[model samples]
Target: MRRPDPVSRALTQVGELFALALDTLRAIPKRPFPAKDLLEQFWFVTSVSWIPAMLVAIPFGAVIALQLGTLTVQVGAQSFTGAASVLAVVQQAAPIVTTLVIAGAGGAAICADLGARTIRDEIDAMKVIGISPVQALVVPRVLACVFSAVLLNGLVSVVGVLGGYFFNVIVQGGTPGAYLASFTALAQFSDLVVGEVKALIFGFLAGVVAAYRGLGTKPGPKGVGDSVNQSVVVTFLLLFFVNFVATTLYLQLVPGKAA
Candidate 1:
């Protein structure tokens, strides 16, 4: 038999992922919500991701502040540095950093756990007993990721803004009052709303992708590892693409605050 072409294989995988995502969504509103599983997973995700997210957010914010500070000075718009940096952090960097941590830490763990179950035939056993893996396992994990991402987005945003503020004021000799004032000058509340929205969607995508790859694992120890890696890589790609699209739509639809 002839093997499927690359495009066909890609399309097939996309179809399967889409179907899995649909199943997860449908399973979400069903009876007997897995609150315990969700709480456990939420705690797990938070425990693994929060410190790393904060560590990364600090440098991310500092770099944005440094770069934008330099650029704004060169352009003779140094007073807008805080607004630019805060907007960058809150509107883009925070959600991306939060989700990256979620995908790398929480998503990888979820993938590995589910993949292990798949290799051990536990998923099949559940199916045989009329238990939906999607409902019993996937939904809670996905919701956990969503909840974690939303909360972490807020945390990262605050940390990032603080980091940026410090770098702008102390390192760049920007006035603290100017820095604080500039934030309200250019950033609208919608900027924040978009960031949270990105976090929510990105979380859902990360969880679904991880679960799909995990459930599709081949029967070997190596297969579980490979699925975990693939899930992270796939989640990262999807997050960036979705972020770009979401940002573009937000820019088009929501008018920026008057400077």
Candidate 2:
């Protein structure tokens, strides 16, 4: 075989990584859904994460509405502002933005937890006892994130719409009913389903990527922090990359209509 160029080698490595991830997914145990674990995950996403994500989304919505209003005033078709705002925020802003908040807030917490576990030799101990670390550690966290993301995205979508409307109707006194009508008319079930699907993928990815990095930490104090930081950076990068590819595939190649 001839020597490969740097670009080709990098691509090959990425391919291997994807293949390994697929293997891991297939290896996941086919067990009953853990209700208690899911409940806890819901709590984390709802009570813990929902408010913060909403807080971030609300301000984001306000800013978008303000900008949209300013832009549309000259065109005299400001009635479309609400539809525009909702479409923009829901696609990538609400769910994707909530993922951002989660990475900084909840994601860091998860990273630190795993890092500490690794540092204290708990992971080693689990392996020593013939336990699957993926099941004990990775699965629960992943489940929690996936569940939490659904709730957080739902909250963000609702709050984002309301927040955008508040800015449009209350702040700018734009036509609230007209905006709502436009949104309802144009908003398809496909958009909502796509947003939810994105949230699920994003949430699962956030947990797995963060846990993987965090669990790989050396058994030390500094290692814990370093892993957490790295987890955040890596997960952030993956989130964007996945978004681009997933959305492209979703819009262009995927079939069966929107919903």
lDDT of each: 0.95, 0.77
Which candidate leads the pack in lDDT?
1
Q: How well does candidate 2 score on lDDT at residue 218?
A: 78
> Model 2: runs farther than 4 Å from truth?
1-24, 32-38, 253-259
Clashing pairs in 1: none
Candidate 2: tens digits of C-alpha lDDT, residues 94-161: 87887877777777777788889988889899999987666656677777787788768888988988
Assess the local accuracy of residue 96 in candidate 1 as a C-alpha lDDT between 0 and 100: 97
Record all residue pairs in model 2 with backbone atoms less than 3 Å apart, i.e. clashing: none
TM-score of candidate 1 relative to the true fold: 0.99
Stretch of 10 with least lDDT, candidate 2? 250-259
Native RMSD of candidate 2 (Å): 4.1
lDDT of 1 by residue, 75-129 (tens): 9988899999999999999999999999999999999999999999999999999
TM-score of each candidate structure, all chains considered together? 0.99, 0.85
